[model samples]
Target: MSAPGLLRTERARLTALYGSLLLLAGGGLVALVYVLVGQGLYASVSGVVRTVSPAYRLPVPGETVDVGRSPEPARTMAPGETPTPEELKGYAFTQDLSDAVTDATRHRLLMYSLLALAVFAVLSIWLAWWMAGRVLRPVGVITETARRLSGENLHQRISLDAPPGELKELADTFDAMLGRMEHLVSAQRRFAANAAHELRTPLAVQRAAAEIGLAGEPSPQKVARIRERLIGVADSSEHLVESLLLLAVSQEGLEPGSTGPVDLAALAAAELAADPPHALTVVRTLAPLTVTGDRALLGHLVRNLLTNAVRHNRAGGRIVVETSSDGELAVSNTGPVIGPADVPRLLEPFRRRAERQHTAGEGAGLGLSIVAAIARAHGASLAAEANAEPEGGLTVRVRFPLPDGQGAVRGAPGSKIG
Candidate 1:
């Protein structure tokens, strides 16, 4: 059979293994004890028997007694007659009789010991099998629950009732993993629904613009307006498609040999200089921090952060871009007040505030989500929180692991401008 089949069939292998070990130990102990007790008891009993009868006496160990070789038969003691020492010496224990008793007693002892050991071994094996089953009961539950689960039934959990140990911990961890999978699956469903709606809206708009504007030899003015509208719709669709593809790539993870030392401070500074928000006051605290990751993705991360801040900000508001020597980057902007609870939803694809749902000229709602995906791909942590109300905005932070053999570097002085 295959290895997995062998393992399944021998689920009680631990029981048999331990039982065999105990049996071997018990056998060794039985042999040692039998030898000691048998030798000592036989010697003492034979000595006593020799004393009981004056006609016989204990002989030296291993000596053979030959009755036919005796000079004469044993003689009985007469009343009121004293036996000579020579007579007593002649009746000294015979080897044949001693050997006979020794063999019989040894055989009986061996027989009893073996029988008892056999019975104990059988009991031990049964007990071991029971204990093993009890110990592995949680595993059985986990397996059954897993077999019953799929993408459709991810709600099921293995609530194992085993004692607190490795098995219980494993079950709990498995349940936690299922919970995460369920959450991700639900989010994916929502994302698909939202993506379909978003993609469909522009197509519907373009179709209407074409059907109405191109009918019956339209005027140049109507043609230009319709053509412009079509181009804008097409551009929006292209942007949405591009964003989706980038998100996929980021989540798919950085390719091998695509990672190298990247100066995060320099990258952020370049993004800020490239597209300085005209209406917002920009402040920069660029530090010299080096990290390892895909530089293109890193650039996209910085650009998205800046664009998110600019798009979702009040006119003439402040935008603070900061980088630290400790491989950290943070961006904060002044915008509409956001609740603490709603801040986490911003990292999800196509998630937007109700107020922004009707806002125009705002790019597809994937900037922060793409940032999150890229951060995850680089093994960096990203967190966003609502700034205190009154002067409301959001602060998003990303922490990256430093490149190998690199140490913290001092940050440059803060610079403020638009």
Candidate 2:
């Protein structure tokens, strides 16, 4: 089954379609009445004239039928039954009967034409409504498009969906216009994102070198000096480049073509085991659950959730990772409670809390934005909140739908990857 079409504007077409249907139905009904009653009247009158009325076969002496014209039998019976020539001769007949029938037929025909015209008159009213509807259909479409349209959609056109006659073609044209608009907008977004990312690498290297140079003898006095000088350059550079790169990646968007079955729990555990040990206590119920998605993207999504959790945590707080097959995975960490006001903006790039002042790292506030991008790419859902534990702090969660169609999250595949 296919999904129903989206109507950019449809009221006009609907009105026209209804009007036309009504016209067609009414015209048909009138025509039907004419056919039925006219045939009945003709049959009844013909039968009465033929059966009850007497037709004169004799003429007054010396008088001839057909009004002095030679008498002719318009119709005769079978050979043995036909009146003889002598019998018809000198017979006077009333020519008025045939004339009467002719006159009657004419009157009835006139009446039929008039009644039919009346029916057509009513039909005309409906026809006017129908025509008006058709003419206005395009206008209605244009109006609806205008209502929903914005400057961003300037290139979008309007057309009918399933329109009769030229309307279908019109609709196709409209869709084509919108296709162009989408293409242009997407291209612009992609260009900006790419340009920003390209500028980030050099800035990053410079910042890192600056940090290493000022680190060895750093103290309140020395650190204050470095921070006031080289740190400023690194911070500003990192902030600018990161913000730009984030914007670029978001615009380029995630391509989900890499979807395949990947074991998320295994990935999460492996990530936890890498390099620098976690400073905060970590707890997890590892599952062998698998899901279909881009592995690299999902890995990044998970890392962002972890990084956010880590960055926001109070000293020595605990982080918990939970996995399940209700098509969900969640990670929660203890950190400073984020105020409700800041929660909504957390996922947007370059949107940091106003009270925040961490000069140690090059976080251009793109972490959550990347998380959001990765989530969107893989049809996953992610959320963040303060842990509800009485000694609460921040908690972030990333969820992935389970593979094999809604089964429980698997655990202990029994074999270990070396």
Candidate 3:
């Protein structure tokens, strides 16, 4: 059934349940009252019988009563005359009349009690229905609000102004859930739009190049030039695709099988060895820093920071990579001074600072975004700050939580001394 129909049905059921309970309770009380009234009436009649029975003098069967003095009086009839059958009949009728009155009074009392009980039953049921509606009013509101909700109207909240109770708590929890869903949906929409925009640029470039190359006469030199241009476009497309894939992986988070303890110091050293810095002085202050996370993702995090630092630096500039025993990894580089306002945006997907210079084949602007994703996946903290010097540069730091049974080592904060 539809939600509103179901809710209405539930309300009806609640009313019925309440009415049934009231009937049971009210019926018991009425029955008790009826019994008490009957008992009291009977007791009063019995007391009257006990108090007045001795005051009346009635003749017994086969007994005589003196009507006049008859010591020497002439007898009117036989001395032991019996009562006529009519007199006996009249005596029995009188006794039956008293019993009939008592029976009629008892019947009247019973009828009145039942009438009152019937009226109260109806009243109780009506009251119960009303009370049930009052008690479930909040639930009805929630149901209606939920029924009206859709993706476009996710901003609507229950906002129930109710007293403290379970219903209020339920409304609060539902509102919180709606808030989270709204955030996630908004983020998803933004990501899709950004990804489409990024992918469209390279595809458009490749298409334009192909059309230009095929539009004219076919010559060997021209064909070679077209081939080179096409290859460069293909290369850029490939790089962008790879970056997108990595970003997706980071956002989805690490798999259970890929999680383990990785030494950050060792991972940084290995990445530097594989891709050494060119025209930039590299300094490393590596200490053993162990953190529990996915090794491949952690490697990507380190690699991206290093790449960002190198690609954005000036000629003969310096890069400093530091890892401490306290699970802190920092990368600082000397480049164009950046504004403090742009620091936060640099970590968002497809966001690049306008002041920072980019070399050819630098990146697709997802380096720091991936880093931020990986850090969040592993429950680590990431902080980025622009250098204070007039030359302007960026410093990125990631602090991983210490592993189980390992106390965090405290030390002085590291500085960029390259």
Candidate 4:
């Protein structure tokens, strides 16, 4: 059977179980009452029979005695001829009526007990079914709502109206999960559209360069220029595709047992050294720091931060990279002043602040986003703040959890520059 059929069967079983239990208890009570009343009535009747022995006598075996009737013909006896007490004890006509009364009472009691039990059994079953339905009504509603849910109708919620209980908690949790799913889905759709747009721009450039430059057989100089343009566009497209792939992988998170302790300071120093600080004054306050994560991804994260700082900086600007033993790394650079509100958009894929200068080697704007994804994969926190310098720059900080769950040591890293 399907899930709903199984649930209905379970509900029916619960109803039957509860109803049977109640009916059995009631039947037991009725039976107990019947037995007790019969026993008490028998005892009382025996006592009365013993008390009135002289007035009433039971018939002997094999004696056909008529109750409440004299065996002899009705006749007036003389004073001397009156029956003695001893003779009356053996009187055949004086039959005991207590036995008959007790028997009749027991029969009536059994009949009433059976009748009441039958009536209450039916009543109890109905009550059980009603109670079961009341209790499982929330479950049914949740099932139906879940069944109707899809990507199209994920906006709908199981806003169950019930008192605080397990069922209500379950419903609330489900609603919370649905909300997260909807957000994730919307974000994914946006990411896809943005990526397509980013990819299309380069392709369009290559196509235009080809059509305009190579319409007919041209000079060697023109072909060389067109070649350079196509190569540049192809290179940028390749970089964007790689960035997208890396972002996707980082979101999936690192594989288990594929991580180790990496020195954050060492990684930062290496990235800065590898990339020339062209027309930039670089300052580093590197301290010994270690964190557990994927080393390659960590290296990429460091490289991205440095690249972002360099790309966004003005000519002859200063760049400061800092790392501490407490597992915090920060990169700050001098650039056009950015607003605090605009800082968050930089962490989104393909989002760039309008005030920033776009240089020839400008990135696909996924540097900070990839960094954020890698940080999340390593169970770290990332935050960006606009620097207070009049020549404006931005500072990005990342904090990773200690390997042994030690307390974090917080301290200011870089000094203000003129």
After TM-score superposition, the amount by which residue 10's alpha carbon in candidate 4 deviates from its true location, in angstroms, is 3.0
- Candidate 2 C-alpha RMSD relative to the actual structure: 11.1
- Predicted candidate 3: what Cα RMSD to the true structure? 8.2
Among these predictions, the greatest TM-score belongs to 1
Against the unseen true structure, what C-alpha lDDT does each candidate score? 0.80, 0.60, 0.77, 0.81
RMSD values for the candidates in order, in angstroms, are: 6.4, 11.1, 8.2, 7.0
lDDT of 4 at 85: 61
TM-scores for candidates 1 onward, in order: 0.83, 0.56, 0.69, 0.78
lDDT of 3 by residue, 35-77 (tens): 7866676556644653454212234445443322234432233
Question: Model 2 — which ten-residue stretch has the worst lDDT?
Answer: 409-418
Candidate with better lDDT, 3 vs 4? 4
Ranked by lDDT from best down, the candidates are 4, 1, 3, 2
Model 2 over residues 150-173: C-alpha lDDT tens digits?
A: 757666666465546666667676
Which pairs clash (backbone N, Cα, C closer than 3 Å) in model 3? 337-392
Full candidate order by TM-score, most accurate first = 1, 4, 3, 2
Minimal lDDT window, size 10, model 4: 409-418
Q: Write the per-residue lDDT of candidate 1 for residues 1-418, one digit (tens) a residue.
A: 8866655654568787868887988899899989898868767766665655534652333443332335665444445555456544555544455667788888888999999899989988997778788777888899899899888999989987777899999999999999999999999999999899889989998999988779889999999999988998888899899999999999999999999989989999888888779978888898888899999999999999889888888978989998887778889888889887788788899988543452357777889999999989998888777877676888788888776566643332221111
Between which residue pairs do clashes occur in model 2?
58-92, 59-91, 59-92, 193-248, 288-410, 313-335, 335-394
Which should have the higher lDDT, number 1 or number 4?
A: 4
TM-score for candidate 2, please give it.
0.56
Query: In candidate 2, how many Å is residue 85 off?
Result: 13
Which of candidates 1 and 2 is the stronger one according to lDDT? 1
Candidate 4 local lDDT, 98-167, one digit each (tens)? 6677888899888988998999999999999899888889999899998998888889999999999999
